[model samples]
Target chain A: MLVIEDLQVELAGKTLLKDIDLEIRPGETHILFGPNGSGKTSLLMTIMGYPQYIVKKGKITFKGVDITHAPINERAALGIGMSYQRPPTINGLKTRQMVDICAKTKVDTEGMARSLNFGDFLDRDVNAGFSGGEIKRSELLQLKAQDPDLMLFDEPESGVDIENMALIGTTIAQILQKNPPRAEKGKPFVQQQKERTKMGLIITHTGYILDYVPADKGQVLYGGVIACAGNPREIFQCIGQMGYEECVKCTI
Target chain B: MYDLEDLKEKARQALDKKASFGGDLDLNTFDRSFVPHKYLAEEEICAIPQEEQKRLIMSGLDVTGHGRGGTYFQKDTSVIHCQSKEEGIQVIPVTEALKNHDWVKDYFWKLVPVDQDKYTASALLELHDGYVIRALPGSKSVYPIQACLYLDKENLQQNVHNLIIAEEGSELHIITGCATSPHVKRGVHVGISEFFVKKGAKLSFTMIHNWAEEMDVRPRSVARVEEGGIFINNYICMKPVRSIQMYPTTYLVGDNATAMFYSIIVGTPGSYLDIGGRIYLKNRGSRAEIIQRSISNGAHIINRGHLIGEAPEIKAHLECKGLLLKGGIIDSIPQLEGHVEGVDMSHEAAVGKVAQEEINYLMSRGLSEDQATSTIVRGFLSIDIKGLPEALKAEIDRAIDTSNKDSM
Candidate 1:
C-alpha cells in the first residue's frame, strides 16, 4: 500500500501543494483530475521523491516504510516507478541498454520492444529524436521491464494520436494487472481481486483512458487540496458538464 | 627527385624555429644518438617482458600477431621486427627502402614539408628508422597491419619519418601504436608521416598513443587523395603526456575524392595537448569531414579543426566537442572556409560539462549517481565511424573502456 498524509510541498521556495491526503491499497487504481497549475504534477513529483519538491510538513509511506526523505533511486529500488511526460534525452545510451538497466538483469529487450512496436528504435540513443507517440512507447517499455509494484503515469495520452491511443491504453491496463488472465476469466470477482497486487496512480487530462482501463476512484485537486472524491465515471461526467470552478464551489 | 644537399640546408635553417602553438621544448636537452636492439622474429615478439607487452596491448598492438596482416616493431631508433605475412602488402624500414628501392625516392617527403617547424626539421636532420607500408594495385588486405613505435631509451629524442601508399583499386587498413617503456620517464618523439591514396583506392589509418607522463611528442602528417579515392584517419590518445602537438592535413586533389578525420583525446593532470585536423576540398564533387571529442581532467587541451572548400560543388564540415572535468582548460576552435560560391561548408563546436538533467534521467531508471555519471562520460567518448572495420571498432571500444575506468 502507498499512503500520503498532510502532504505540504514547496518548489524553489514557493508553496505548490498543501494539506494533501491520499492512499491507494493493493489492487486499486486511482485517477487524478485538476485544472492547469492545480498541483497535479507537483503532487505526483512529491510522492516520487524528486529533490526539488521540498516536503515542508508531510510524510510518505510505501509498503509500510516511511519514505518522505528517501532519495529518488532508493524509492525506485523499493518498487516505485514513474513514466515521465517529457523526459530528457540521454545521448550515446541505446534504448536497448536502457531497458537492461531498468531490469537490473538480463532481459529479452528485443522481445519486449517488438511488443511495443519499438524494435526499430532499440538501437538508437535514448529518446534522441523520438516523436510524441514513440516517446510514450519508450517510457512504457522501460516501465514494463522494471515491473515495479507501484506505477505512476503522468499524462500517458496527452500527445498520443488516435491510432496509438488504444495500444497505449491496453498496455497500461496489462501493466497494472487490470486485465485478468485467461484462466481467471471464469473465477469469482472476489477471488480475482484478491490475486491482483499491482497499484497505479494515473493523471489524465482528457479522460480518454477511462474507456479502456477501469479506475476504482477519482479525486479533484483544487487550490492545492483534494476538494471532492467519488466514483470515477460520475466525477468525469460532472466535470464535463460544469467547469472545475463550479465543481469546487459545490464541494467546498 | 630533389637535391639532398638543398633539403639538408633547409632543415638546418629551421632547426631552431619555434612551432606555431603549444609549449616550446629545447631540442638540445635530449640525446639523439641511436639505440639498437636485436631483431625479433614473429615468435620472439611474444617473449618480451609481460609488463611491456601489457602497455603495448593497451595501445592496440597485438604481440601474438593473431589477426594482423603484417607487423612492424621499432625499438627506440631501429626496426627490430618488420615483416608482411599477407600477400599483396609490403612492410619495410624507411631507411632500407630509401637505400634500395627506386620507387621510395618519389614519395619521401613528397606531401609533408620538411621545414614546417622545429620538430619537422629535427625529423629531417636526425632521421631515425620508421616503416614504409604499401598495398599492391588491385589487391585488398585480409587483416589490418599492426605497427608499434616503442621508446625504451631514457631522455632520448627519437626522430622518425614514415610513408604509406595505397595503390589504385586497392584497400588497406593500418593500426599504429606509439608507447614508452614503463621505466623510461622523460623523452621526446618527433614523427613525420606522409600518406598517398591512389585513384580508386581506399585507405584507413588508426593511431593510438600511450606515452609516459614526462614525454613530449610532435607528429607531422599529411595525405593526398586521387580521383575516386577515400581516406579515413582515426587518432586516440588517452594516457598522460607532458606536452604533445600535431595538426594533420589532408588534400582532396582529384574529383569526387573524400576524406574523414575522427579524433578522441583525454588530458590528465600535467598534460598539455594541442591537436587538430585540417582538410582541403580542392576539386569539384569532393567532400571532407573532421570530428573531434576531447575530455580534460586538470589538464590544458586545445582542440582545433579546419575545413576549406576551394572549388564549386565541394562540401565540408567540422565539429569539435569537449568536456571539462576536475578543473581543466579546454579550448575548442572550429573553422570553415568556402572559397567558391557553390561550395557548402559548416561547423559546430561545444565545450561543457555533462548535463545534470541527463544524469537525473538515468537515475530514475534505478542507477546510482556514480553509475549515471560514468555512463554519460562513456557515451560522450564513443563516436560512430562510418566505414571502420568491426575488429577496429572493438579495439576502439576497449581503449575507451579502459580510459573511462581510469578517468572516473
Candidate 2:
C-alpha cells in the first residue's frame, strides 16, 4: 500500500534519513526496529508529509499516487493516519469533537469510546492531563474513529502499562482487522481467515508489541539506512544478543 | 419625592473628573462624555427600523413567550415597550416606578453609587429612561425577562439606570441586549445597573452587546447578594466597538452568599475593549468565582479579574485566559486579596497565541487549517458557566459562534 524509494529527509540543514527504501504490500505489517534517534519517527513524519520534514530526495507513493509534496491534511484525506509518541495537548478542544472531525461520516463516538473504556474522557480536553497510557489510548481512539487504510504506529508500547498494553493490543488488532485471537462462543474462527487488507508500519524500540501484532517482515535501520531484513522475532533475538553494531557490520 | 439638591451637586462635581485610566486602550477622544443637544422622542425613534431592533434582540435570544416572563424595549430616551406576563413580578420604567413606588427610588442608585465613577455620575444626573424589574417575595420564574436597548440616531447619548430586585426566596433571570444600528457613525452609551439579591433569593443576569466601531460603551454595575442568596453574571461583547471599559463589582455581604461571574469578550480589528470582574467576599461562608476568556484579532484587549476574601471561611477564585491572533494585543491580569485568616483566595491568568501543534493535530484529522484555527478560537471563547439555563447557554454559544465567524 505504501512505497518509499531513495527517500532522503532533512531538517534545518541536518540530514536525518538518507537513501531509505522500503515497501509494504496489502495485508502486510512491517516492523521498523531502530535505536534511539535512528530516524524512525522522521521516516513516518516524512511519509505523513509534515511541512518541516523536508524531502531532500525521493518520492513517497501511496495507493498508486505520488504524494511527495502533499500537505498534511491532504495526506490524511488520502487514508494516512499516525499515532504520535507524544501528542500535544489542546486546551479547549474536546476529545469527542476531535473524534467527530476524524470521522468520515456520522460515527457512533460514544460506542467507540466505551469499547476502548475511554467514555469518561469523551468530554475532557484533548490529551490535557492525560497519563501516558491514556495518551496512547487517545491516539488509538482517534485512529479507530478515523478508520484510515494506512496506519502508522510510532512506539505504541513505549509508555504503556501491561494492563493497558493488553487492551491497546486487542484494540489495535481489531482496528487493523488482524486474524481474531479466537472465535466467539458457538462461532467458528475460520471466518476471520479471510483477506486482511489493512496495511501498517509500526515503529518499535523494545519489540514488546510483537506479542500482540503479527508482523510479516522486520528491518533494522542503522545510521539512517536499512541494516537488515528478516523475521521480526529473529531480528529481535539477534539485536538482543549481538547488539546493533553487529547488524550494521553485517549490512556493510 | 426626596431632596435632589445634594445629588445634583455631586453629579456636577463628578462630571469634571476625568474617566478612569487604568486600562491599556487609548481613549483621549472619549475622555469627555459625548453630550447631545436632545434625545429623540417617540416619533424620531422611528428612524431606527424595526428590522434592526429584531436583529439585535429576538435574533439572538430566540424568545417566543413560551413561559412566564416580561419584555422591555427602549430606543434612546423613550420606553418603547414594557410588559409582564406573570403576576407577582413588576416590570416598569424606572422613572414611572420611582414616581409611583417608594422602594424603587430607595434602591435605584444604592448598589452602584453615583460617585463611583464619571460615567455613573453622568448616567445618574443626565439619565433618560431605564427599567426597574422586581420579582416579588417567594416568586420563581422559569423564563427570563428580556430587554433590548438599541441606539437609533447618530450622535445620540443613551444614558440608562437599571435596577433589578429579587426579593427574599424569589428566583429570576434577566437577559439584556445592548446594541446600536449597524450604520451608526458615532454614539455613546453609559449604562449603570444595580442588582439586589435578597435573602435566599437567586438572580441570573446575561448581557449581550453588539456595537459598531464608532460607539463608546461604559457599563458600571454592582450587585449585593444577601444571606443564602446566589448571583450569576454572564457578560458577552462580540462586536467591534471604538472603546469599552467596564469592571463590575459584586459584594457577597451575608453568610453563605455566592457569586459567579463569566465573561467572553471578542475584540475585532481596530477595536479596544478593557473588561474585568471583581467580587468581595464580605461574610462567613461566602464564595465567589470569576472566569473570563478574551479573544483579540487585530484589536486590543485587556482581561482583568480581582477577588477579595475579607471574612473567615470565605473563598474566592479568579481565572482569566486570553488568545491573541495576528497583530492583536492581549493583557490578562488576575488578582486575589486575602484580608483575614482562614479566608482562601486564588487567581490564574494566561496570555498567548493559539498553539501551532494543536492546529496541526486538528488538520491531521481531516480539517483544513482555517477550520482548525476557527474551532480552537471558538472553543477558547466558550465559557462553561455553571447554573445557566440550557436555553441561555445555547444563546451565548450562538453569539460566540457568530463573533468568531465575523472576526475571521
- Among these predictions, the greatest lDDT belongs to 1
TM-score for each of the candidates: 0.97, 0.91
Q: Which lDDT tens digits does candidate 2 get at residues B1-408?
A: 344676777777876565664333222343334333344343444354566745665335323444328877776777776778767778898988878998776787777767766777778777787899999999987778888787767777778989999999999888889887667768778898999999999999999998878888888899999999999999988777888888899999999999999988878888888888889999999999999888787888888888999899998888888888876889887888899999888888888888887787787888889998898887787767788788777777877777778778
**Candidate 2 chain A: minimum summed lDDT over ten consecutive residues — where?**
A186-195
Query: Candidate 1 — what's its lDDT?
Result: 0.90
Runs in model 1 deviating more than 4 A are: A185-187
Tens digits of per-residue lDDT for model 1 on A57-80?
988999999999998888889998
Error of 2 at A189 (Å): 10
List where candidate 2 sits over 4 angstroms from the true fold. Answer: A181-194, A241-252, B1-3, B22-50, B57-63, B66-68
Write down the C-alpha DockQ for each prediction: 0.77, 0.63
Clashes of 1: 0
- Model 1 scores a TM of 0.97
Model 2: lDDT of residue B390: 85
iRMS values for every prediction = 1.0, 1.1
Q: Candidate 2: what's its TM-score on chain B?
A: 0.91
The CAPRI-style docking tier of model 2 reads: medium
Q: Model 2, residue A172: what's the lDDT?
A: 80
